[model samples]
Target: MHRVGLTGGIAAGKSTVAARLRRLGAAVIDHDVLAREVVAPGSSGLEAVAEAFGQEVVTVLGELDRAALGAQVFADPMARERLNAIVHPLVTEAAREREAAAVADGSTVVVHDIPLLVETGQAGHFDELVVVDAPPELRVQRLVASRGLTETQAWDRLAAQADDEARIAVADVVLDGSGAVSELEDQVDALWAVWADRHPAGSAR
Candidate 1:
């Protein structure tokens, strides 16, 4: 199976690309969804998080209070690292299981949609790395408009991740997300064609 690591900064439209890839017949493993699942109520991930950051980050419903935890970690690098320490391993294992299942099922391509593939130093793990890129200013604008983040908060979020240059350096393919949605879709279609040539659909060994 062809393993593709897909990543981009916040609001860079990586999700759009991932969805398009799915529509074009790629098996997509969404790491963000796995991250949430790993920390769901009653999970060891949630327990570890609560142990590290205190019960204040858990809700009365026994769920993780993501916003509260975000407030604590986003402003502190060490806190963010600590949270990653608790969550990343679980996410990685879950992803590996899903990828293995896809391979066993004869899936041709598996796209791992990881938002922090670069920051976490996971780019080299994929057969090919695809990065969806947009200008930081554009991403900041999109974040403020769509997510209700203040300008400073948006910039802070951007600063918390690896920069465009760093992501691009590791990318075998870079899809420009600053243009129209159609353009991004076209890029995904082209990528799907290339992957199909490399490993024809339903032909995984």
Candidate 2:
């Protein structure tokens, strides 16, 4: 299996690339989705989070109070690290299970769509590292204009992630995300053409 690590900063259009790849044939394991699942109400992941961040981070309905935790972590580096410590391992285990399933199902390309791929020191784990590049200023503008985030909030989120330089330094493939959606899709299609040719049966369609 070709294990590809896909990552980009906030608003960098990484999702667009991942979706296109998914349509082409790659099985994508989205870490953000796993992050939420691992910490679901009754799971041990949630228990670990509650133990570390306190019960206030969990709501009356036994659900994670995401907003509360977001506020805490965004404002304090220590709190963010504590949360990462509690969540990252669980997410990794879940991701491994999903990857195993994908491989067993005869997937030739398995993409791990991880936002913090570089920050978590996972660049070496993949057969290829795909980083969707976009200027931070553009991303900040996008976050404010489309996501309803205040400029300060957008910048804060950007500040919390791995820098562009670090991600670029380790990337095996770089997709430009500073263009239109169609352009990005074209790039994904080009990559998929190669991947499909590599293992023809991987493309079921």
What is the C-alpha lDDT profile of model 1 across 1-205, one tens digit per residue? Answer: 6788999999999999999988877789999999999999999999999999999999999999999999998889999999988899999999999998987877778899999899888989999999999999999999999999999999999988988999999899999999999999998888787776776653333
RMSD in angstroms, all models?
Answer: 1.6, 1.2
How many steric clashes between backbone atoms does each model show?
0, 0
Q: List the residue pairs that clash in candidate 2.
A: none
Against the true structure, candidate 2 has what lDDT?
Answer: 0.92
Off by over 4 Å in 1: 202-205
- Please state the error at residue 2 of candidate 1 in Å: 0.3
Give the alpha carbon lDDT tens digit for every residue of 1-205 in model 2: 7889999998999999999988888899999999999999899999999998889999999999998899999878888888888899999999999999998888878999999889888899998899999999999999999989999999999999989999999998899999999999999998888777886776652
* TM-score for candidate 1, residues paired by index: 0.96
Alpha-carbon error at 146 in model 1, in Å? 1.0
